[model samples]
Target: MRYETRLYNALGVRLTAEHSLSTGQYEFMWFIGGWDGCGANDLAIAVGATSKGVDCMEAAGW
Candidate 1:
């Protein structure tokens, strides 16, 4: 089957974070929301860190 390509706006709710170190581009993510409210799109914009995630904003002290 042939594939189709497209551009995405901020409203796109990323289904997954497919990071590409070579080009720094994410692919195969799904966009699932409307862009209207200021913070409404914030949740859809950023993905939460997993249990093994690194938090630079957190304190270094254990």
Candidate 2:
């Protein structure tokens, strides 16, 4: 059995925050969902946490 790991970097990141809440949550959900057969362009546009400059690794399994 193997393991999978995903890395996200937000070193020089900028986020838009307002009175209600930060757009971070929404973006993360959409980005991750895209990988789960949610929509398209899962690699385009930095949506949220799991956005651009993110690294994902899926190891072999049995």
Candidate 3:
């Protein structure tokens, strides 16, 4: 658990510093890009987010 937290935080820092993206945005980009026919609900489930949250991400141009 401790190592996982540290690694996650480190990944977040690197993503932000290098790409100017939040972890969620990075995840969304990769997931949506790789998933050719996925809907927002599927993305929400895959990313552990709510459908409403996925809608919000789309609205925000994620």
Instruction: Kindly list the per-residue Cα lDDT of model 2 for residues 1-62, writing each as its tens digit.
Output: 12222222221133222222234444644466567664325545544533332322111110
- Which regions in candidate 2 have their CA more than 4 angstroms from the true location? 1-21, 37-62
Give the per-residue lDDT of model 3 (tens digit) for 1-62.
99999998999999889866778777767877887787766655455465666667678666
Alpha-carbon error at 16 in model 1, in Å?
Answer: 23
Ranking 1 against 2 by TM-score, winner: 2
Encode model 1's per-residue lDDT on 13-62: one tens digit a residue. Answer: 34223321111112211121243442323433344432112132123221
Candidate 3 Cα misplacement greater than 4 A, ranges: 39-62
TM-score of candidate 3 versus the correct structure, residues matched by position: 0.59
CA RMSD (A), model 3:
4.0
CA shift of 27, model 3, Å: 1.3
Superposition error at 13 for model 1 (Å): 22
Task: Give the winner by TM-score: 2 or 3.
Answer: 3
Q: How many residue pairs clash in all the candidates, one count each?
A: 0, 0, 0
Output the better candidate (1/2) by lDDT. 2
